[model samples]
Target: MADAHRPDKDKEQDAVRHPAELVAFSKVKAGDTVIDVWPGKGYWSRLFSPVVGAKGKVYAYVPAEIVDMKSDPMGIAKAFAAEPGYGNIEAISDPLAQQPPPDMQNKFDVVWTFENYHDLHDSFMKGASVDGFNQAVFKLLKPGGYYIIVDHAAAKGQGLKNTEDLHRIEEATVKAEVEKAGFVLDEESKLLASTTDDHTLKVFDPAVKGKTDRFMLRFRKPAK
Candidate 1:
């Protein structure tokens, strides 16, 4: 279920705040198959639905553990099922450690992760490590498919050190890890950059909650 504290309407608007511009730059078009990983509150999922249109498909991939934590997982999934223009949309809750469903393998033109990469460390504590998550993303895309990530940025030298505490990761660390999965960094966008986010407070700290410094990375699965 959507977090009661985070209404669907608010979540929808927040999706428009920064990531929408990045998505536009991604050149996503009608008839493209897209996946929104860790689709918290279904914001990106909702956005992708219309962008993909009737002929295309959008899969909202939520980790199985999220569902196991509450009874509303299926309820949240069902909400998307009830939308009118989202006939091609689907909700998939697979264990984070596993690959995306076989039916989805090599099926997407784009896979997007937003404001959620830092949680990979948390996902690890739950048994699925970051490597597992990246590998799954790698396997789900076509050879030339796009994998886009946007997440809170840790201090330059912090590396992955405070990922668990601050829910942030070094951009360099993320770049290296994704490259190891055979993805090539295609582009970087500075639209979300903020010099004022001093990298000390937790992202959720009231002062910097909405304006946390972040890095945007676009990578592609190499074509054979």
Candidate 2:
């Protein structure tokens, strides 16, 4: 039987260009409070809303620094706020690296970033520097909560060396940085791996666009 709390298969598939089946197979679950960091257009935010169910909450954290960018961050937040069946979701537009609001401290079960990790290095997002952002994620989760990241992959050894110019970061660099923030690298998924990408074009470049090679990483806060 289909899981009562899970989203309909078609609804999930229609939401994103990538195969939703592969994404849904990752370890997110119902009744888990989730944070979707920098949710561009709220695609993953929407997918997570139903999957986490009524008992769970999804917080769409949009860093305040970039909230006024040409990308229309406020419009995205407004759209998410107006969506149905997502009463538990909220959009927070705070400056990056600051602590989440008091009520949210140490309260989330999962904190996720999809395709936006590289933005941490962007000049406009300085307040949410890589280290500060990671630290905030660590502080927001429960002891055993999850930190999930999916991002475009630069060539191995790049070490975020070209993140500003190329907008991709080495997977090893991401793992090292997150591990340094105190999470245990629990698992990895190859569902989004693609070799056809030449690693030269920007992720938004029309050439490779939606098929850019990406790394899917899952980390867990160690239970104390």
Candidate 3:
């Protein structure tokens, strides 16, 4: 994390984001292939690229729905991948459907998305099936590979009710949905949790914007 090439702006948020601990928890190691789904601003991508090393690869996937948007997320991803010392990183786009391409199935060591799982349930994604998404994730990983999700926590039992409006989802809902896809719940972390976050306000509300009560979950595909 002390690498000089990282943007100063990204470094500033490390204290709260706990990139090192989360990376360790994910067990991403040198020579492992990783897919950083919907890697906005390339924050996690930047960290993963170095950890995965020259022999490793990091795919910064931009969902198909927003690939053509005015913001040009694909372009942003490409630009980040092209920066110095990031040769191991590449930018990939989602296919027309939310599901990953057939060639990508069973090909990765880790599939990780940070703070954007709730967006998959939002209308902006054009009704992408969360179940299909989870199943696709299951198929994408190699046996024993990891699936990591980090997102803001909503009130317990709220389920998808706050996903669109508050940009949060119930912790239990995520666990149930992902587990249905056949992943075993490996571990959960409170690294990003905030006791002061009452789980009522929108994640974007000024008071909670950067410090929302977030949940981190790790799921694993059985080697068998």
Query: Model-by-model lDDT, in order?
Result: 0.79, 0.79, 0.90
Lowest summed lDDT over 10 consecutive residues: which window, candidate 2?
1-10
Q: What TM-score do all the candidates reach, one by one? A: 0.87, 0.87, 0.96
Query: How much is 113 displaced in model 2, in angstroms?
Result: 0.8
Q: Flag regions of model 3 displaced more than 4 Å.
A: 96-103
Give the better candidate number (2 or 3) by lDDT.
Answer: 3
Q: lDDT per residue, candidate 1, 1-224, as tens digits?
A: 13343345746566435645866866578999987887766767777776777898888877776776555655686686557656777887777768677886788799888888878777444767678778888888888889998999999999988788898999999999899888999999888889999999898899888788988899999888
Report the number of clashing residue pairs per model.
Answer: 1, 0, 0
Where model 2 places Cα greater than 4 Å from the true spot, the runs are 1-19, 22-26, 100-103
TM-score, cand. 3: 0.96
Backbone clash pairs in model 1 (N, Cα, C under 3 Å; residues 3+ apart or in different chains), count:
1
Better of 1 and 3 by TM-score: 3
Clashing pairs in 1: 1-72
